[model samples]
Target chain A: MMDYKYIEQLLERYWQCETTLEEEQILRSFFHQGDVPEHLRQYNDIFNYESEAKSEHLSEDFKQKMIDLVEEDTAVEAKTITLSQRFAPLMKAAAIVAMALTIGNVAERAMRENSASEVAGAPVIADTYTRTEDVKATIKVIDQNQSAIMAKADSVKTMDLIDEQPEIIE
Target chain B: MKEISFKNDILPLGDLLFRLALRIVGGNRPEAEDIVQDTLIRLWENKEQLADINNIQSYAMTICRNLALDHKEKFENQNISLCETDHDRADDHDSPDKALIKKQQYETAEQIINQLPEKQRTLVQLRDIEGKNYQEMADITGLTLADVKVTLFRARQTLKEKLSRLAQ
Candidate 1:
């Protein structure tokens, strides 16, 4: 016959909240051993129920389901970028380069036309001014020649009149 | 701080949390399962702060307890009594009458426990069923150590008195 006096004392302490966890565990072990006095049998159900309830567990299916749910959550949180999205910065750079080239071509053409018009009109204005100056110089030279000829002709007529007036005076 | 894997560290706590939830929700298994799922997901969502906690199991228990209580409040009227389906296992050595008597004793003890108030019931579950010390119980329950002892004493006394009556 085994002694249960210690178990009884432990049970008394257990109800008073004075038993250590180990001591309570000892009581549990004792009650689960299947041979108890008639007086101690009433307490068997409590310990047995406690021990059996620990067997109440969530199934493996529950575990796998939870893992799937969590993994799905992680998948949703981290979305994968497509190839196009990955090259978005490069695409933006290419578009900007294309736009800049188009603008440069248009601006260069506008500048070329402006300079070409200036070059085409510049010589015409210079030639017109040069021709006006030439005409003025030609007119001045003709005026000087006509004045010298008139002076010379007047001198010769005075000489002829001197010679005829001498003969009339005799 | 050690790195905590959700698979290794947190997932394994599902059974413990489920048991606690089952007790808090008054043996509503489906609701208990839901509460545990919510608790685990919540813990995983807050995994960043888990490394800072001293005891992750106690922290998880606290979260499970709070969520179970919230669920219990929402569906208070629909709670099934505890141990309603807890039939005793048959022993080959025992006679049929002995097995029936054992079953009745279990059912009676369960009914007596179920009649306890929610706080006392939870204390009993945490201490006797879970084998948590007073400090762990205090931590899980957010009660002071003295308060835990007092509450557990009252709960154990109630169980003892009711169990003695059943013996009579």
Candidate 2:
């Protein structure tokens, strides 16, 4: 004889939303039998519905397709790490250095320009024409030196860098 | 406190995930399976957290459901498999004649269920099919306890109405 008290307790927990997965499984199992009690017949349809719904299964071919997709994803993931693993540190360090150098150069130039402009204004405002000429001369020299470095670098053969890329057929 | 292995421990959750996904996507098996695959991979990646999780099935169900919803949103117009036929149970019933009649009733129920809005359908699936507790259903669907119960009540009410109509 089925335990009426246990079934009642399960029904209570079921309504209260306190049944565990195992307990829920037991309920389904009990309800699944061919011979359900007459008093509990009202719940048979609900339990049977649950049982029929739980029988939902993916087809074999669909399952295999999932496995294949998962395998492909893992393969792609492996390749991604393999490619990035070699260059990831270099990329990080290069990014850090590039950012640092760009910030430093911009700050340094801004400070120098600010100082020079201040110097130009201060001497002119102080009515010191001679000192203003000296400041102008110093700024000109710095500009000339910068241009000299640029001209030297410009004179280096562009073809030499292009050839280093190994795309030249000849 | 069980040690979880990825292939043995985690992969098995794929079936449960698929079931949840199928429910969410309204029986779109292909999309459901894809969601399960995605959920499994995520769980495998986050296996470290599984040990700390109070309910792995609920956690996995949430992942699977979310993934399936995202996919359904993305492919809103894509032709999906008519999933009601996937578990047709054509030859399993003891009496073919009764089974045929029951099949008609089952199809009618499926049609009514398929017509439900996504939230109601999923709520019904979680409540009536999966037999989830309110707390677990709330956890899986990311709904509050009251919201889960309310939605489930409305869903069951709708189904009961439809079933009654069918009876009539």
Candidate 3:
């Protein structure tokens, strides 16, 4: 006969997440035997399922198919290796864009600071009319650059659209 | 890394995954088997990650549950509705007498559980059917211990309420 106290303690520990594998096995065995007490009958289905669920087996054909899937994935990865191997040009292009942006930002800031300092140093020496004309020329240059950037952005969008509407469906 | 043999390390979990899939998918053997296969492939891909895992079974359950939910979502998306007839069809194979008895119990029980959202069903399966502890459930689900307890309490209450209806 099983010790009811010990079994009860193990059940408590089972709920509390402290039971070992052997203790869990004991619970399953106790529950599996023909005569579960009235109170524990409700748990019989659950415990039996817990025990039997572990032994649920897959078919042999399924196992072979899984191995085939693994092989297929590996083969696909191998085939894609050359594509990733050609990423150096893309990496270089990204680096070039980054460097140009950094340099342009620094140059623009330095030029602005230099002009501000010059204006401060020679407050009234330079002709105000000449400075106004120079600012107008700068505004025209900025307008031209803005239109160029917008045109470039529009072309990129059109290219994206073309790619999305693939002519040949795989 | 050396190739992990399916027969040695992972195929054993197929039966566990199958039953779990059966319970979740409700006798849709093909879909459940697909999910089991997917879970095994996922484990093989992430085998390195398993070295840190204490319980492979719990890890596999998490994968299986996620895959099963994904399949259900896809099924719903495809307009493949889960009709009451789907389960009724399963009952058709049983003898009329046994079917009557089972139908009575199944209706009362399944109605209550079927009313539960998918998350609650998954939790009940892990805790009640699979006998996973709170911590193991917490680890597998990434849910807190309190969350597992509250969900489990609600699940058991649902079962209890339905089971009591039989006495009536």
Candidate 4:
């Protein structure tokens, strides 16, 4: 049998929480050998519980259950993922097509509006000053600015034509 | 840092974490089993968070404890009685050492140990049973080192007094 004196002293220290981990291990190992005299037998259960409590585990099917549950969880999540993934490319392509059509329509309308504005402005300029005397009279009033007036009108019409094209496309 | 292999690193912690969940729920095996499953799944979902953790075992232990406690709280709210699952699980896998034990003593031993406060019981289980050091215990239980020592001290004291009384 082991020395009762040392074991008693160790048990006292253990209650006080003064024993180091090694001393506690020694106490556990000592009791584990089942060599205790009468006085120390009471402490056996406490030590034994420490070792035996570990065996209170889940069943063998636990790991497999977890694996199945995890797989199922991921399966549910994958559906939303595939839905989003499936839409992603189609949405992107649609956006690209929509954007291209918008630009093409705007450009086509702009070119048409630009040509129409030029045609209208050419006729208006021609209609504005038919005679040189009328031109001189308007020039005197407008300070020899017939050509300048036509130039300003042409530039303003061009800008207005460019601005209106996108509106017409929509 | 090396990559944490799920099979090698994470799965290996299951038994330890299971022991912890079992400890927290006072040996309720099924609930403990659920908590372990939830912890594993949660950890897997948030595996990205693992790379930042210094001690994976401690982190896993914390998750198990918290989830077990949450289950414990729900059970209390529902006023459900803790069943014989604790006894059944342990008895399901009786060891040779256990056979040497008197039936009443083995039964009373775990029940008495389980009766301690959650923190104290877990500390004792992790330290004495699992052979974890004080630092790891502190990390796993989210207690300061001094608090771990104090809780463990009280736990041991409680076990000694109760076991002596039971021995009669």
Best by lDDT: 1
Clashing pairs in 1: none
Scanning candidate 4 chain B in windows of ten residues, the lowest lDDT window is: B79-88
TM-score to native of every candidate shown: 0.71, 0.57, 0.51, 0.67
- Model 2 lDDT tens row, A1-170: 76688987886676555566678677878877747777665555555657776766756776566567666766777543576888999999999999999999999999988987887668666778777887888777777766655665589845554333222222
Q: Backbone clashes per model, in order?
A: 0, 0, 2, 0
Q: Which window of 10 residues has the lowest lDDT sum in candidate 3 chain B?
A: B81-90
Candidate 2 colliding pairs: none
What would the per-residue lDDT of candidate 3 be over residues A35-89, giving only the tens digit for each residue?
A: 7876555555445545544444566888788778777787776444576568978
DockQ of each: 0.60, 0.16, 0.16, 0.48
DockQ, 0 to 1 scale, candidate 3: 0.16
- Model 2 lDDT per residue over B15-118, tens place: 67777777667667767777887888788778788999988888888888888889889888884565546435744855878677556655556667767877
Question: Pairing residues by index, what is the TM-score of model 3?
Answer: 0.51
List RMSD in Å for every model shown. 11.1, 23.9, 28.7, 16.5
Angstrom error of the Cα, residue B65, model 1: value is 0.7
lDDT of 4 by residue, A1-170 (tens): 54578888988998887888899889888887777788788888788667666765556688777767766776787444677787999999999999999999999999888987887667767666567667676557564354555666687866554333222121
Q: Candidate 4's chain A scores what TM-score?
A: 0.46
Please state the CAPRI-style docking class of candidate 1: medium
Q: Which candidate leads in DockQ?
A: 1
